[model samples]
Target: MREEHVQDELGRLLAPGRVDATAALELLIRQALAMGASDLTIEPRADRFEATVRRDGVIVPLAEGPRDALPNVVNRVKVLAGLLTYRHDLPQEGRIPADSFGADLDFRAAIYPTSYGDRVAIRIFNPSHKDYELPDLGLDDETRDRLSAAVSRPEGVVLLTGPAGSGKTTTIYALLRHMLRMDAERRARRNIITIEDPVETLLNGVTHTTINEAAGLDFARALRSLLRQDPNVLVVGEIRDHETARAAMAAGLSGHLVISTIHAGSACGVFSRLLEMGIEPYQITGAVTAVLAQRLPRRLCAACGGRGCDSCRSTGFDGRLLLAEFASMSSDLAEGIRAHMRLQDLQAIALRQGMVPLARQGQRAVEASLTTEQEVRRVLADA
Candidate 1:
């Protein structure tokens, strides 16, 4: 359908009187998927309910409807997610399988109560689309080569650092797939295990497990137990706490090639974050192999030269490209960590040793006309 046609359909579906909440929600999700959105948000206000879709790291308005009809729509989503419909005062989360809508996508639903009404956010995942190999991630040649070399090591922690929704998990999965293919080529069967908060993708021949905090199975506990399973490569979804961070470092030092993601602004920031998590400097120096920091900048629309086009929803962006920097462990870097060197000094060493910053990567993209400078700045403003 054309852009105008989609808007017209949404307008009719979200019309004030006698709305079919279920049908409206279905249309919204279908439209979001068509736009390559990673998330859909439905927020209730005093007089109306607003919907937005996040695509290429930007949130664009979708539609709005009468406040009276929002409850029905929220209830429909709750029904699909199997959330408690009666409890609107508390926060709740649930999952809606693709089978519910007869689509090839999974929806993770979260509801939080506000003074006005309940707010609903849904994350869409297409697990069947597993093309996120290292090459597919759009890493520059040098960064890709560095990352591949880091992951090829037998026993060390290769950490991916980035903010939330920065595609860290996707990159980690790609690395895992790359390793699996390598193992196949060598005809060497190696044990690989992963522990995630929610196992997003189902990978064949790899042990994928999820943390159940309610069942006393958290990341730290899960890592301790998995250590006994003789895993050659361990993938921890994220290190969120002190215990998990300690366990991950220990695993790396104990001869397991550990791969994980952590919330850090840059490759150099990962060390400080780990130190803040109570990890000893010696442990970090001994166990960490590399840190890869990344971001996703919206690519400019080719159809309209970034001026605005119906094809890009008038956002001048059609898709996203990766901006990444890799910092590998070196003898000098290890010594710096052991000596408790400042982050700036450590970063200087990384630069001297041929590490590129994310800003430099973004500049390259801009020069190539792959994305706009404004978009790159927006994505890296915090950095």
Candidate 2:
């Protein structure tokens, strides 16, 4: 569609009281997609409703609607997501599979009660967006080779570690696509299953299961039954608790390739996270094949020449690139983990084995002018 056509449609949809509830909901979603937003936050206040959309890891103001027009928008969203519209006293969660925005998009919405009204947060996942390959994820040749080799193994766990919004999901999806491409006929004979809170990307020949906590089906429960289905490859969205971690470890040890994400500051920190989840260090060493930590730094707009320019939306930065650090469980690293070595000692061993640390990757990005030192520091300050 032409840019002018889209702008005209958006203007009509967002004409406040002119549109009904359904039209108002579509207006908000369409506006977000047009702005390339990853998330939308709508909070109801005493006199008005506030909206913000997250773009390129930064939150930008979207709109503030008059109090009268706000509830209709909220109600329309709830109805589409299959949540209880009459109740605003408790937290509610729902998902909507939508295509009105011209792509296959999944909307995960959550409503929570507050003093003023229900606050709604919606996460938008576009499966129709271009799929990425290994190189497209910005992995160096060596790191890519190591990860490819690890995933090629018959059975083991590969964990992608990073804080939220660090592109872990995208990396894992790319890896899965690569694996499927290696031998389509062989893969066709195998059962691949993914258990996610809300399955983001749609993969061919894979069973995607979204977690339903309200229905009493969570990661741990879903995984237990999934094992009976005899899957050759299993993907867990996020290993948040001890139960899910143990289930993933067991599935991996029992000859299923397991992939999952965890919240850790670095690859080495993944071991500590597993241990803190009540998993034994020896168990972690036995099940873990590799851990990859990734971050997304906003790349400087080439058209801007590192100065704020219209092409970059005047943010100085335009797009994003991957900065990754990884560690594999080689014999030495495995033994160290089994022996419960210090984190520093283990990291040193990996470094000697030619593993790149996050700081070095960030510095490389800075030198290449893909981003700035300030951007790197902001993304990796904890690392």
Candidate 3:
């Protein structure tokens, strides 16, 4: 749809005192997705309400509606998320599934009290997409082969590390699917379970549990409980603290294949993070199979042809491509780690053993025009 048409539709739907505010909000979400937005933010100011959508790593304002209509829109979202509309002092979070856009979408909704009114933000996740395959993530042939081999291990920890929004969870989901597809008999016998904060993506043949700190259900507590369930493959959404890291590492040692994500700059940096988390060196050496780090570089939009266009918001970039680096642990590397070798020395050995560094992978993406040098510099510099 044209931008003007979208604007007009929004204006009509958001007309003051409109009882169809829920329908208008749903239309707004569809329009945001059509504009290639990954996140939608609605802010209520003193005079009016402003809405913005995140596209290509940048936030662009979409529309502004009357302050009177803001409550109806926010309440509609609150009702959908099962949050209390009457309460305004405390923040609340909830989620609901919407298929109004002709796709299965899981929308996470949160509301926060403000000086003017309440603010609402919604994150959209599409669960029916099949683009989470290994080959689909922008991994080179050698790195892909090594990663596949790493996950094939019957019992070890495969950690995907990167900053936020770097596609770590998506990659982990892809790895899980890859493991299930490689063998039918194993899939039939093995039980796969995941403990995630929000359970972003849904997968068949896997049991997913969400984190509930309010009810005393957390990652560490759940890991200890799930250990008795005989889960062949365990997935921890993230290793954030000492307790969770210890539990995840212990699970790997006890003969379960553990897949998890951590926040780190490179594959080589994962060990330092684990050590900083107060985990023993030997525990990491024995159970770690591989560390894969990834980033999402904005791909040039086909509709723009690398030039400014309405479809791409004149940024020349639309979607993102995966740029990844991985280091698979070898016996020699593990031995050196056990011996308390210097991180640089261990990283050198990993590089010699076909491990690709993030810089190298990102450079390859730049050379292939999958992304630009400026973008690479920005991401690596941040790392």
Cα lDDT, model 1, residue 262? 90
Candidate 3's C-alpha runs over 4 A off are 16-20, 99-103, 185-188, 310-313, 331-346
| Candidate 2 lDDT, 202-238, residue by residue in tens | 7887889888888899999999899999888899999
Show how many residue pairs clash in every candidate, following the order shown.
0, 0, 0
In terms of TM-score, which candidate is strongest?
Answer: 1
lDDT of each: 0.87, 0.83, 0.82
lDDT of 3 by residue, 1-383 (tens): 66567667778887765647877787778878887676788999998888888765567878887788888989888888889989989999988656644667778888999999999888877664434788887787888898898878779899998777777877888887887787675645568899998988777778988889889988999998999998988999999889999999999998999999988777878887888888898899988888988877788778876686977777888788777878887888877776777778878888899777778877887787777888787667645
Check candidate 2 and list the clashing pairs. Answer: none
lDDT of each residue in 1-383, candidate 1, tens digit only: 55466667766776777578788888888888888888999998888888898887788888776788788889999999999989999998899978866687789999999987889999988774445988999887888888888888889999998877788888988988999998899899689999987788988769999888878999999999999998999999989999999999999999999999998888988988898888998999999999999998888889998888888878888878888989988899888887888889989999999988999989999999999889889888867
Cα RMSD (Å) per model?
Answer: 1.7, 3.0, 2.5
- In model 3, where is the ten-residue run with the lowest total lDDT? 123-132
Give the per-residue Cα lDDT of candidate 2 at 67: 64
Error of 2 at 18 (Å): 6.1
